[model samples]
Target: MHPQRECDIQAAPTHLITLGAEVAATLSKDGSLSEVLQICSEIIAHYLKTTNVCIWTFDQKSNTLTRVAFGGKDIYTASLPKTIFCQEDYLENLKARLLPCNFRNTPFSSRLYTLVVENNLVGAIILFGKEYFTEIEDIVLGWIANNIGLAMERFLAREKQQNRGETLLLKLASKLRHCLDFNSILEIAVKEVRDLLQIDRCHFLWYFPYCQNPRITITHEAQDSNLSSLLGDFSAERINTLFDKIRNLEIIRIDAVRESSLDLETQEMSIDLGITSLLLIPLKTHSGQFGAIACSHCNGSRYWSDSEVELLQAVCDQVALAIDQSEFYAQTRASALAAQAQAQQLTQALHKLQHTQSQLVQQEKMSSLGQMVAGIAHEINNPVNFINGNLIHAKEYIEDLLELLHLYQEHYPNPARQIQDKIEDIDLEFLLEDLPKLLSSMRIGADRIRLIVLSLRNFSRLDEAEMKPVDIHEGIDNTLMILESRLKGSGKNRSIKVIKDYGNLPKIECYAGQLNQVFMNVLANAIDALSEAEEKFQIQNMQIHIVTKMLDSDSLIIRIKDNGAGMTEEVKKRLFDPFFTTKPVGKGTGLGLSISYKIVVEKHGGTIECLSEPGKGSEFIIQIPVRAIASFN
Candidate 1:
């Protein structure tokens, strides 16, 4: 027998020391309150030689005792009272210092009785053995009561601690949900797990698909820098190899580790970092994928509790939710930014389109003015030319008439009328000479006035208002006539020649006034180009060529080619651009070609292009569609 058992047997006859020791050892080994009570009943029945042994736990709220664990030889077990005695019944006995054995008169048969301390009357142990109980047996029952009470206390403490941990985890989850930033939430989760579970090192590894590796992003690391270094280089593969056995399992706990259990690499790493034991938990989210959290102890191996695993799993859930939210916010912000940029680009394009439209309208107006000027100038030139020529002839005739008058006056110097009676017969010569002189001078003045009136009427083409089908050649002819005076001015003496290769063509539908303006602009530009040409040799062959042709479609093609100082590619490129001119300041508003371009192209759907090269002459081709454009109603 065990020494403690023999000492109990020597003390009392009824006591069974062996049964008491057996019960205590059973409770200690099992570490469970319910199992401890069952062992207590079995020990009393077999060793105390009792017919019945029943254990009842107290319900403090109901002030009653109820059978909780019992074992007995049948004496009609159904008739047994579930409640032995209430707290009120025990109150008087307890105050009078009467032993619980005094309650034997009631339905209960047990002799020895004890209270289970779970808030007042937690439970009781009733031992009914053979009569004439020995002192040793009484002592053994006392030991059983003490051991049961201690076991119940331990169970209650453990339960309370578990409930507290669960509550803490719930609070942490609530806080994590409120956070929008993934990193912030992760950091908090790591720290809370470490603090709550009292772990030495805690690290969260984020799985990166692109790299095929796990990144230790957030950590509540220990003080050892070497340990951190060891963990930093640890890869997902190595971790998998170490924990391969438990990879697919749930809640794996390694209570202890031997040096031989660690692979060579892990062992070496642990030596450097002074790590003794490690706990690796696969963090699973609601979707059922695995991330990992690694905790290590530098001092010694750790036995991780069930509560610790539960807490970590709770944190992992929160982290997954937070990360999802963060990604959603990022995508939403990016979409909004892209939409805003597109809107801005559209607005800018609209503004540019409006500006171009405005420029087109202004150019159209300038083209119209150029046409009217060309027409009026052409009409005025014909009369001006006639008047100018006649003026010179009239001057000559006047001089002759004046000379004849002077001669007649000298011949009949005095008293021609008195002597006229006698000399009347000779007056015929004087009358003839004087009358011829007077008639000659009057004819010269009348011719000059007629010329002025004719020039004035032809200068204004008031007859054509709206557009009409007209011969383009006639318009060119009229333009040249009007500009004749300017063309024949001192500028012409510089040897500028105009060549015309006008093709025979039928009259076509066109804005006659506008076409005339086109011709004037081309001619004027040619003249300007000729003037700007450097006087290299004798300025002889400065020529402007104008060609006109009728196309198969009844459209007209007018081309003006100049052999002055021809334009370079740069000049030709911008020739039709509005507000671009090479003419001297104030001499050109830069609208001539621009206006013509718009009128022919935009209004009539014609095409214009310049063909020119450096040192080579430039040709501007204008192809106007003969068909009138339909009006937009």
Candidate 2:
């Protein structure tokens, strides 16, 4: 009652404390630690009436206190120390005491000093001017320190929680990387987020291109029967609107799901599901858009914290990346498999085409042979008919002459002078000797005609029967017979000498008709070359040598050689190619050697090759397998 204030030290107002309480409460309520720190610094600066206030935090790596929060102008100047506090300046002192000391005269000097926690010195709070310090000033400084320390502790705790959540998200992302199934990964992501964030409901929706409506609903913990039924048919318009809003970095906070009238159907469905709050985040990929993740909270109103939104965004990014990678891998594998299948199909088609082409070529050869057979038959008919008629007339004439000779013997029993003279004139001894020789010659001519006809028929062996046992000698003989006229020199010139050196062989199972064609082609070519050379060189010594031998129980070998102008290496190379020939265009069809090669090698499962040199001659060797092929029937 007797106290009279010397100085105007008025009692601090309750409203001032109330205002500080309100400011502190507002700062503590903020979701972001950075904003909270800025708000704390503002409160401190306003209360202290200082031109500058700086908040610093410890940097463990640099062992320094770095400015984290600052208020007022030009406080962060160019000439100030990079760090206001350092371990070299204060760490030793800190190890020995709990309170920070002022260092005004030392290199690490500051005007303000404070302790944050025991053995965990946070940082120094710096204020300019020491005259402003007093009892009330210290109280204010203590309150500032206490408030900042509390805020920092809370901020650190929140940071650790956020880090743990990020770590779990990364682990989930790693698992999602191994998975290609979208639904399974989505389920895992939703379940993890629901449990980790402590939300009541979590659902995922996938947007499909060109689809009018696409949505997937999920419920966690509790399900409303009506809501469960209506979830499947939930309107996609709400999702679209939500996506458009969030795509622009706008946060959509629906504090009360029941109160939002924007999507009536969604609202009703949420009410049915007993959902009080819902947060939906869009899932986007690098290329384009994917869909969205809808997380719901039941039982009470829900506010989406800033950290949760950040986590959901991260998870959505991870899911999008994983899905994109999976789709890429799936498409690549499919394309590879499709290419392989196409290659296999092309290979099969090529094989069939080759087979059909071979068959067509064989048929063409047979047609050519048919035409040749008809021509040869027409040529042989005239000679055959002449020989037959001449032999018949000659037989009658011989019989009548024998009877006349007997009659003459009876009529002229004793020789008269005229009769004896006539008989002497006739030269009876010569007639008797010459008659037998003339008849034998006629018979030989008839036999020759018959043999020629038989050979012609055998050469055109058209029977399409199964492979049968065939005599190689017969085939060679038939070929020679058909080629004999060509072999003999035309217009009374010297004939080619065909030297046959045939070894003893057994009948081998083979397509006789095809083998006959092979022989005919080889022998005909040899005769033609030899004759052409003989005519060209005017040298009559033309020769063709044919040799046959049984190589083994399973094979037969044939060689045909000619002493004619040999083929060049270039000609030899294309000798077996269809439609390739050295002969004049009209003289050869160019298919003879090609067809011969096919018959000897492909049809008979044998080999045909040539040996020749320019200025020498040409030789062709054929080796045939004698084993019978199994009948397809």
Candidate 3:
């Protein structure tokens, strides 16, 4: 039978068995790239019966080769050319196929190589010895080559990520030492590092102080248009619950987002914003935090490394140092304020004070903004640190499974009965499919946390220009969100229905923040009225109708109407009067409507009035010039 047909010679079982036994140990996912590559060289040398086995990597910047690893070396050579691997003929050979070539200048010895890392043909094995192989031997060499390729793909990706993170930290630490401007610290740091990392976006989110929870707002953001903009103050409900990891200087990394511990709403919101994965590293000390440095991946998932985590922690240490240097004298600011106040001479101060007062007002607003941001940073730091700590273990687990699965296919093409049983027990196919979903979840979770911080940042934008075109609807939306819980339900268990009839209107020249406050006052009052009516009338359909439309060519109108007991003529007449309120004793400050009226009328060159009858609901009508120019200064 053999004489008749014996051409189907397969690779020996010993070749497969030897590779199977060593592959897992040599190319373990947890092994460092250098360590694995070195082991790979040693294994190949042992099998090929050559002591002159070496791995040489190419340097693209310079036409050079760098020896990464050598096996059973006893040959001393100071005459080796650095650019041997980068030569045109050498590259052509590598691209063509695995082939032998003359070694050095001697035809007596020979060399052959196979591609290792694919990134710019990063490296390859150089078998520097006279060798002739049978076809089966060549097949074994091919197997090792393919294995090297797979190992390089994973190891190099991780290595690249780790190196980038290290470079970022080192540069940031160095820059912090030389940075002189304390006021613009957040802005400068984020911009510099974001550019250096070549990431889609970066931000330093600060926590709001007045809120009881870890409510956050973004104070500084450096971003590209690759992702949806996250720039606004978000409600506390949206904040991520993983700041503890960040507090411990752990870095949170999300490689590929699919499913996560975050709520569905939050995940959806992140997807809406076009963020896929991100890294949140806390800039915190034992005492407190400066904020977190968020490196976002908008386009796809990216592997994060332990080296990257440590590097970020070091960077955070430097950030905290800078913050300490910058904010260490915060207590002395009060004394400085008192000194400035005493310097104000009455008559001289009046004119100078008017201009200075406007300046001071803006300064105070910024100061408040700064305080809120600082708190947010401190709050979000811990959770991000916590997430960072956990992510390492999670990644290792996933990598272990993937490595095991890969080895099963590569080494043991025909798995034993016990191995097959285990695979079936584990439902290997389903596990493979589901493993990636976990990463997707983590990515979604990280993105959700980022979105909250972004929103808060957007809400805190302080325009230097006194009169600029701004979205009034955005301001209203933010205000309504702040009071969302109150409107969602009342003491009587009745939900308030808010009907918004917004019309297409051009962005009006206005103070965006001030307008937001106006919306807050009006919306708050409407909610209060609805709550009262819900209790008094036991009404299930409490409603607040908000309408915004173009009043004329150059003006816009806003109307807030409540379905509650209406105000009488006397109440309506005194609604805009200072210190006037129909609310029961302690509940009524009465200045809310009065201040709101002044904002719409005197400040923005607008008109405001209450239109109501005693038994009917009340409607507050406001009209503002769309393009009116007013100098706050």
Candidate 4:
């Protein structure tokens, strides 16, 4: 013992004994290491009249001494090292001594008492502003340091146990950080937590907070052998009660259901599930709660440590983050698919609109042409009829006059010298012979004009309203007559010969004007094709075969084929697509064939298709129902 402690023990032995008893009693309590140290510090300071006191713990791993508690004056400790390296000679020598010297250069006197337990350096206590110490005071402090060392040993052992759980939590968090799948995250979390804690069962319940009444679903579970599953055991009413607590971000820990403050219903339900103790950690972030993780012990009533609760809560946090990430990924993928579908629909709509616009323009042009042709046919038909009627009357009057002249010639053969002079001057014999031939030529010309006017009226059936039964052959013939000028080549080229294969067909019910327009379009295209072929190939034979036949009782077919410069497969594919033309710009409007298709297919509820190959003839096949069944305006 130090000389000063010996003097102190003799001067105040009872007070010294009392201080030792109080310090021993404080360290013996089942409180935290810091709490006990703080109480011991106060007791020592009060009895000794010390100005400053601090307790430091020793870390053998790092060879450092760290101040764990300070119970007195703060100004003295402000300049002192909160942590001191044990590698220093002064601190290294502390492990072998009961009373170490105060080596720090301070304004006041200082003392250091090294604490040892079971032949190991656990911690120490330092006192400042104490100029001298009696023998009894030194002895009491020695007893207090010993008690503090023993208390630190117990606390360190408990801390080592906590570190084990913390290490496992860190490892589970590392695995979770690498995983982004929601279900996989839940599976890994529950299994690792149950295994680490050695619990009876562990499960994850999933729910969405945004719903009116969110359902808590058991998504994943891990358990020991012979344990009953809690899957599908939570009813909606039970979930509501359970979720109310979870949503508050509370960690509900029931060490023993019968002893805990939980309601009877929860206690009974827990017992039914073989759960004597339960720990539930809510999975949440700053946004909102996602779900909860339930850990249960079924063997008997078990106590849940703080370290265990902390480990499970940390794992649940990682699970919530992974779930949020997966939900975002799924939403992004769905949005991309929806956008692609919408883009395709828009492209199709635009194509349809273009076709409709082209068809409307073509229909307008055809309507104007039909009106003009009907007017011309009307104006010319009357004059031609008048000329035709007067020719017959004039022929009869000239023949009667010629017979009278002949009778006069017989009655007065030598009577009038003036008449004889007129006959000699006018060449009477030639005049009588040519007069009848002139009348015959005039009558033939008038008949040709009448036939042309009739063909025009037939081609432009503008006066007819609604669908009616009309001669299909007559429509074809009228279209042919209208295209006669094109069929005849302009210069040295020969006329395009048309071969008609008329079939025995009944009168079909159809729109007269529209059907006539279809025939006109087909014949016009045939003439144009033959003209192009004549210009390019220059082969002598140019023929268009117009064939009509009764395909069945309800339908009829018309085929107009031409020996022309037939189109390639590429052009044929878009042959009836509006505004898709092989002809050069300004020469062709590109709507002729498309409008013809609409009139045949849409207007008449019929079918029209083209078949052709390069250098071969092109054929347009139209199949119309014999009796038009489609109602129209």
- Estimated TM-score for each candidate: 0.41, 0.50, 0.44, 0.60
- Computed on alpha carbons, the lDDT of every model, listed in order, comes to 0.64, 0.69, 0.67, 0.79
Candidate 1: tens digits of C-alpha lDDT, residues 158-249: 66556667766776677766777756766676666666666667776543323556533333343334444333444545445444433453
Q: Write the per-residue lDDT of candidate 3 for residues 1-633, one digit (tens) a residue.
A: 133221222334575447534754688747767677778777766766664666666566775667676674545333344336456666665522322223444433334555645445666665655555555555555556656766776677777767777776777766766664564766767786677667788888754434576655667788986555676665556545534454454566777655555556656655676767777877653345436777777777766556655665566667778777666545467678777777665646675554455445544755597469556944885686578567768888988978887986998789889988998999988988887788778867876665555445445554323667888887777667657778877464677888999999899887666666578778888787777776777656788999999988989999999988777888788887656787899997666776677678777988888888865778888899888644522
Clashing pairs for model 4 are 5-134, 5-135, 6-135, 7-135, 8-134, 8-135, 8-136, 9-135, 9-136
Q: Top lDDT: which candidate number? A: 4
C-alpha root-mean-square deviation, candidate 2: 11.3
State in Å the error of residue 415, model 2.
Answer: 30
Tens-digit lDDT string for candidate 2 (1-633): 113321212354454465357557865685676577666666666665555566666655666766666654554334344364454557556322321333233342233554366566666566543244555455545555666766777777678769878886888888897888756777777777776777766666654444566544332122233344223444455555554554554545676887765477667756776768877777666556546677776677887878888888888778788878877777888999999999999988885675557558767767687668756766786787787778778878887897888787888778788978987999976887788788788788877876877776666666544678888899889888877777776785678888999988888777787778888778888877776777777655788898989888888889999998888999999888766777877998677788788777767778999999976889999998777645311
* Candidate 2 off by > 4 Å: 1-19, 22-39, 72-79, 84-123, 153-306, 313-354, 374-460, 471-506, 515-626, 631-633
Full candidate order by lDDT, most accurate first: 4, 2, 3, 1
Give me the runs in candidate 1 sitting further than 4 Å from their true place.
6-136, 139-143, 207-252, 284-290, 314-318, 328-633
lDDT of 4 at 377: 78
RMSD values, in order shown: 21.6, 11.3, 47.2, 11.4
